[model samples]
Target: MSPPKSAQRLENKWDASRAKNMSEPEKLLYRSNLLGSDKRITNYGGGNTSAKVLQKDPLTGETVEVLWVKGSGGDVGSIAMDGFSTLYMDKLNALRGLYRGVEYEDEMVAYLPHCTFNLNPRAASIDTPLHAYVPARHVDHMHPDAIIAIAAARDSKALTQQIFGDTIGWLPWKKPGYELGLWLSDFCARNPDARGVVLESHGLFTWADDARDCYDLTLDIIQTAMDWFAEQTAGKDAFGGARHQSLPADQRRAAASRLMPAIRGMVSGQQHMVGHFTDSDAVLEFVNANEMERLAALGTSCPDHFLRTKIRPLVVDFDPAKPDIDATLAGLADAISDYREDYMAYYERCKHDDSPALRDPNAVVYLVPGVGMITFAKDKATARISGEFYVNAINVMRGADAVSEYRGLPEQEAFDIEYWLLEEAKLQRMPAPKSMAGRVALVTGGAGGIGSATAERYLREGACVMLADIDETALAETAENLSARYSADVVRTVTMNVTDEAAVVSACSNIAAEFGGVDILVSNAGIASSAPVEETTLDLWNRNMAILSTGYFLVSREAFKLFRVQDMGGAIVFVASKNGLAASPNASAYCTAKASEIHLARCLALEGAPMGVRVNVVNPDAVLKGSKIWQGEWLDQRAGTYGTDKDGLEAMYRDRSLLKRSVLPDDIAEAAYFLASDLSAKSTGNIINVDAGNVQAFTR
Candidate 1:
């Protein structure tokens, strides 16, 4: 069947004036962005692009041809001109003559430096030579799902010929290296009419004299394959509908919360690990299918996915019909133990004498029939990426099965790629990770000024954050904004009232299950109350004590228990106030409650010291901006007390501080972050004043 006219959705958005003004490499960056912006073509950092350009040699001042390939680990969607590694085209091609097929992976690394055009070097991608040998002015490479679905099928060769005719050539599976590059060059030269080549169990490549042509050729081939796929699977329902479960969403969340901690304890070995849960409609539908175990055991649709999804996902058996949380957790714990044992055996079976040190022997992604999909990795971003890839893999596998039987790369082939030197080098070349990379943090009152600021700070440092607040609407909005910047799995929200002990326990349990366990606890939930001691109403005083005092105790108690169970050192930062340390007229209720909470942390620090827990305090004053605590009567009261309008209160407080700097929410958040991180590892029971400078509030 021919591709439909409407199947091609890509339109050339390149502005001629835009290209005319930019340099050759910048134009290539613009083109690469166009290609990567669509996830159907490539995801995250899975693809590469390059162009051949003329540049002057520094020594001879003569124009020379150079191949500018996308550097290793550079994401095409956000790459800059500097992201391209410049190599001497003539010198790089000379390696084709000296290639021996053996030890190609190792030799490729040793030879990369010599082939580059300059002394200041960047690591070129493993596919660099494949682009250099294409004999075109520009080239684009992508791992389009539609293309990989067809190529990874058992009858890939026959499918290629039938769908694309002679316009596309097919290459058999060979590990990417100098040998593969030479083979591609020879095959394309022999078939002059071939506009692209389909690499079996790999990806697709296209080349043309113009950058836009090469990019469009990629989209054209992908559309053709997708059109054929649509026809092949027209009415077949290979994946069935979901099964009705005994538990509802709320119950399932509760059960998952109870089970995740035990499972993480069983599998994390010595290092702390983070976990994420994803139950999107696509995932639940796939997991609930009758043949889910059989379908999932099949290898990934592409080898590149192995780096993220691993060779296969572990299927966890969960019968929602019998929803006993304790029994379910015990069962999951046993299964995780078995999975870890099997992973180690597999690693030992496939390892070579010179193989790199073995990573943690645990599955990165797990398939739970009732609870959706869960991904476990060293950090939040990697875990989220792993889940994303597995979600894509499920769709590709279904597509391949719909057309022909899904066949993936052999197990041995996957092992080779996982341990390849070039792949390892790519990981090593990544920039230093953030401080809280693998940690999980929880913030009380996360919808307010200080809580929101603290949550954002922890997220910026790469920690998985859970925002708990009584204001469900505000919490949802804050979560949406943060999710846009990072990912949904990285920033989550729970509608929790801190004063409710049962609700606090349940919310903390869910957080433990969702992210293994919490490492940092920021107890920042409190309400403001100011009245003369004699005139203070019982309701006003009790409200302050409920949220400010009892709330702190309940949340900290839950966190302390989890920390003790994990036997890992943890940090707790209490957002007290300078008002607690300094006496002010008509502020008895708030001052008393905060002072008690501050002392409670000191007691916890002493008790937790023997167990390696550190507890500290950040006392802030006059952070009026974005503070929900100062709304309604509290704002007017403070304004009247300061003899100014509401807007003037902030400036008046700033003037009173010795340093003349107004205390801000972020200022308090920075102090909290330092206490939560290793920067304050040696200090505990210490209060960091973020009031700019308050001599009266100083503690000796």
Candidate 2:
């Protein structure tokens, strides 16, 4: 359909000058990216695009028509040239001769590798046949929200006809594979001049001989749907009008922070799960609607929507007006159990003889009336993306429900797609998760050397790290560097003074909101001073005690609070010093604070044991290379006391150790990681010294 002139029209982004110099494949990539740039057009990793272009055959030196389609599991928004799979058109067509029927469509996937063009390593997705069999030179299969609102409407076929006047066709929902590709081919052959077709309860498909025309048609078709809906539902109250008022933004997040941890504990039994919360305007509109619960129970129609969000969302029994958080927490177990039981029942009702073993059965999405949505997955990105997908579903429901009744896929069909054998194979083919895959850590004094090293190590192991430090500049720098190496998703930064009790509690809540809950706490924040018994002032003593001993106590206490809320076992690593055990001249205040830190760790270890929260210590001596404590008065004072200059003090500490080695920040970080990791899971109330065999600091 040619979209009408309306204010809701999509921006036409075609740049003639830029495209004038591009190859055919590059133009295809450009079109795909432009279409995918807007979530309203298509969602992340939800759709596929393809082009048929003539290329010189690498093996035969002959001109050939190659099918370049988006590879399996690649997102069009971020895809590059290498993301497309190239296959010979003739080989793809020949597979039509091999198609036994719709019953045997999955068998055709194994033959795709045989048809590779130029030996491209990118595997062709199942949608390859959908693109290959179509007669057009370019094809775009998108799940635009505006068009899907029409596609998922109760009378989808009639709506497609009314909007496009037979210019764009319609096909009932069929699982994508060999048969559906053939269905599209038959439709195009019959409706010769049609611009595209709407797949009922699915998405939109547009095609043209030219890539630019295809892009234009795609934008126009989706815009027409948007404009048409805009006119049809001009004055209507969406979702039968909002049934409840939205909570204030602060209150909304406060509720999510309270709920995510408890829910994570219940759902993370098989594998730990990370969480994401959204209170966006659209999410608020949907969750606060009168029809929200009914529409949610119907589930999502689009395969990609339900695949990411699960069959249906669980409507959390929370009332914003009552503000009963304790009641919500108390009932969460029963709510989640009911959801799991319902999912398992669906599985039993829909299982085929060879269906894959029942999967996690937990709902990926949770909807809280007057609050918003919460989603959980094995990692942060997935959890975030799942929330985004649900928002897309929300948009679809609003549009469809306004003009026509919203319709979800039948339970049997949703089950088939969710449990498709091919999908199970894809799931099995994914690489094993990293060891610290689903854990989150908070590193105090994270701007310093040992702290940054520990954060990086945890990030490398697939854990999310929230860096908390008193120094804002250093904290930002450390977070930026680590984020550059290990994506921004897994690393966050907060300016925190560990000795501040309120700051400690707030940081704990922020981490809960950012990555769901906390599992590891590395209390590495510290300060050092040097003075004889007579010269040690009360202020100096108090400063050292406050930062080293009391700071550790504050962060650990807050972490234990989160631990109780989550019911997940926790690991706490306190970075102390060798001075805690060995008496050194002219450092009474420093040694006393370090000794207090060690004894505090022992007491916490005894208290945390019954709750499965482990507490341990890493003590280091003279970690001078990148140690922030070594940069000030302590270095000069220690040098003067030992008859050495500033440059020679590090060497003195090295020589003082029995093994004669200098301990760097990374070395201390390694010991902290070991104690915080499962390597020392069986041991607590213990100290691992990274001080190169200091005899006097040895444990008894």
Candidate 3:
């Protein structure tokens, strides 16, 4: 049967025209991509799809059934042909005897590799057997919110029968492994007419002989549940309706910005964590509801949800009426400590003798009333995905609580999945994190050569970057290019006139909102002036000081405020100039402003030392390539002073240096990176000269 046409909540996206010419495996990939593209169908990396095709065996020249399923740790939306694990169907079936019993089923995962066909390198997922044992040619396993809502409800088996009668069956909760695969096989054998079955507190599994039919069945099942919920939950208050009105959009963001840094600071004890904040309509509605806390305490039901968001989220205590951020800030330490204690207690209460040691006890998702959701992880992409998973849980809770009583996986069941030995082994297999994985940097003049170079250096080591610059067009272009190289989740941009206090303040807030807080501050915004003391106008001199001196102070002060909030030792790298120490002809104002920057770093070092903030300088001289200052009149003026033209000035400067080398933007960037990284942890209040060994600028 199809979803009822009159009440269908999902539109069938299949085009026979698109699928007519596709081979069996190609159709499997096409179907999987279509299902995964919409989050309503499944979350990122949440589901699997497979097709059984008759193919010639490599060793024997006879046709054999082969199971092609999605590989472990792969996302179906972007899965390539290589992402599928191919295995002999007969060999997979033989594994039914290898399974000793339900208690020894996990050991079956170790035997999956022996069934590999064609020496395929991709590892099969634990759900591989579930797909293999199904009698149909194509199978779809998805965690759609609508179906999961019904599956996670109280007496979900009764709910399933009422909704789809005998067509769709229901099974009690079974930990996914070889044993669960046998259950599905047995269910299909007994009820040959059933199209699918919902695994309680898990997800849906649907199959059909035809690829297009399987795709249609999966969507139809989800839409049927969706349509039924719409009818049943119509005009019903979701999550007991709104207990607190949502604050205005701007105020919500303001509150998020105010609280994010302090929370980031308190949680970053080992490796730092980057944060993601979302104030979507779903998040706002859920956060303002009266039953929000009660429902959240029950935790998420789906295994994939707990894999990303943990057992539950920590609900931040904040009243919409009061809007007292300071009060919330004062209580964060205790709030966070209490959450940690409770998480440890959970581990103690439910852990098995051989369970993997308790993981980070901190909650990945944080819910704030009148604001939105905040999530933190080792990096920006993970943090963002964690937030997305919790939103999925929020949708499931809203639907289940509306029609039937919402039920979460029991605490012991959740802990079993959470601390499963297989899950822990998968995590252990991950590559070591990049040096700057969880760090955040705010780069001033980020569109300029030195600024962009420094930002890239940090990004390569896995830091989140906020590119702040006065040039809006250039900032956008640079951010776009950097984001393309790294995923967009790690790079953000803000426009600001660094000399303006208000603009600097806003830039700081935007950066904090974008990525928890600042770990590195690269103060590089400046303009070069080429004039004798007599020719230099007061406007020109003041302009130089305004950007090069006061501008640095404004941005630095804001960064310090975040550092203080985080209570984390951070790095401040000032891109001053060789002229700050060595004399330069016809550049008094430029040299004076540069000198002011150098002194400022030293002063900051004295005050920041107690808090573990290291202040240092990278003094670069005659960086001709990609320097905005050198692109303007500064180049011609410096050339004229040296009795050479613009083309000859770079050569003249290179020859004038002790090592006779022309310093480039990358050279300065390297020095800036060293100062900002832990490599220079003990060298605060120091300066590194990237001037091809200019003797006069040497710090020693």
Candidate 4:
């Protein structure tokens, strides 16, 4: 069996002249993209590829053959030349002779630095030696789900022989290291015609003179394994039991939002961690399958998954149809504690004196009886990665269970890989991650100047943001621009009128359901009204208060309720105005409403203190460039008050402040971001004035 011709995306497109023109690194990178783009082959950060290149050392001007392997933490799907770590092949190959019976910790990891060809060496993948020993032009290693299905089966050796006969060589469970690579090289030496080898309970490897041949060989072998698996399970239940369906989408979402917070509260230690909810039809079906508890507890599909998700996932039993969600959530804390205690016992059972200190005991949690899975981690990327790997595990395990019993590596082997020094070094190689990596921040009126800028700043700090505004077009455009700039799906848009209590409640629920819970709220939406007290009509006053005062109350009230539910402290910043502190003639309505919103923040701050929630205010004046409030009649009225045209009013407003500078939205956003971040952790119920020293608005 082979992949359909159309499935071959790595077909040779290069003629002799084109191949001559392309650099070796470019050719290798092109093949990496072709192989890594398909999830059937690899998941995020799970696979490595390498090319043996002959290049002249820039410093020495000597041509050397170096093994350019994928660097640790580099995704093969978008790998660049810099993503590879160049190591001298002779030095890397020399280690194979000295690797006899030595602890990988003391020799392999410590000696890797001596093998590098470059002065500033990037950390290479742990499997670099595996490629170096092959002496092939190109090598590809991927944890394709199809191969894992067969490799992790109960009788994996027999299945390996049955599937590919003599073409595939099989190695029993061994933690990846210099020894494993040596054994693989010796096995291939014995079988000179072997297409590849199946590292039992791990992954697959294929090699050829051409990169395309190597990639295609991987695909062909995997397709053959998949066809063999399909034939073995013909007319049988793929899931191995009766399938169940989940609750309706709306009910399922409601249940996730209501229950995820309790899990977050119990699992998050001193630091706050966010949960991400994800489920597909396949995931739901797997969750609903009979005996899922036993199947999911069997361990990960492969060892690399252990680095992201632990060896086993924590499964919680619950019924989404039950109306008593609060009762369900109450019992979850005890269950989570039980899971932690069990994890510690496992750690103690497998401890070596040299093992790294125990990692955070919490593992990704899986829910059943209606809702799907919830992944918990220090940040959003890790959480999503954990969830994704587990989802892949479900499919692979099902495929294995369909033919024979599914089996992962024994607990001891898994422990060895999890605490391996080479694996642990990968984390050390990564740069320090962002501070707000996993948080959720929502900005009201996010289409406006200050709100949009604040959202952008949060995104830069690694927080996923939700932009809420009544203007759907502007909100969508802002989200698009931010997404393009960041090259991430970190921002979402919601059309919301903050004054409507129902809309506010629904929006908050949606945000919680999407990203676990809200970590920060910027209550920045408002309208500006300018009129003399005698000319201020009932309609004008009502409209002004509705947006400025009532809107703030509604949004803040909902956020407060959610924060209490999550039992996690959050930050709230209200964007007030300088006019709130100092009275201005002919703008009684605007000034009064602004003052009301500021006091509203104070009142909420006092209430939220005991729970660790912080509330603050940012007062900015005369941000004319992007301020929607400064256009139309409001701008005309303010210019008239200063006895100047609109264009000259900026200077007049600047002259009124002590610093003699015009305020901008970015200035106010910086103040709000500071208050919402940990910088102002202890300071709440405080106002940050961004008006360039307005004496009238000065506070002692």
How much does each candidate deviate from the true structure in C-alpha RMSD? 4.2, 2.3, 2.4, 2.8
Decreasing lDDT order of the candidates: 3, 2, 1, 4
Full-model lDDT for every candidate: 0.82, 0.90, 0.91, 0.81
Pull out the clashing pairs in model 1: none
Clashing pairs in 2: none
lDDT of 4: 0.81
Which residue pairs in candidate 4 collide?
none
lDDT of 1: 0.82
* Candidate 1 residue spans exceeding 4 A from truth: 1-27, 55-59, 117-121, 239-256, 265-270, 447-449, 468-497, 500-517, 557-569, 578-583, 599-614, 620-667, 679-700
What TM-score should be assigned to candidate 1?
0.86
Local accuracy of candidate 1 as per-residue lDDT tens digits, 1-700: 1122135565556677877878878878988988888777877787789999999977678898989999877889888877889998888877866676666445865677787876546678788878988888888888877888878888989999999999888999887777778878998789987887898888888888887778778888887887777777665655543453435677666656665665565556756688877877667767777656777777686766878878888887777666565665557766777877877777788888877777776888887777778888888667777888887787677667667778867777887888876777767767876888878999998998999999999999988899999999989998998899878868988999999999999889878767978888999987997788998998888888888889999999999987776667799999999988997778899999999989999999998898789999999988987789989999888788668998898899999999999888899889989999989999999999899898989986
Identify the superior model by lDDT, candidate 2 or candidate 4. 2
Span of ten consecutive residues with least summed lDDT in model 3: 1-10
Per-candidate TM equals 0.86, 0.97, 0.98, 0.94
Which runs in model 2 stand beyond 4 Å of their true positions? 1-9
- Write model 4 residue lDDT over 245-278, tens digit each, in one string: 6888888888888777667766767566777787
Task: Write one digit per residue (lDDT tens) for candidate 2, span 1-700.
Answer: 1122145568889998999999999999999899889888899998899999999998889999999999999999889999999999999989889989988999999999999999899988989988987799999999998888888999988989998998899999998888899999999889898889999888999999999999999998988888888788776778888788988988888888899999888899998899999999888888888899999999999999999999899999988878888999899999999999999999999999999999998889999988889999999999999999998898889888877899999999999999999999999989999878999999998999889998988898889999999899999899999999998888988889988999998898888888889999999997889888899999999999999989999999999988988887999999999999998999999999999999999999999998899999998889887678888888888998999999888888899888999999989888877887788889999998889998899899
Please report, as a residue range, the 10-residue window in candidate 4 with the lowest summed lDDT: 1-10
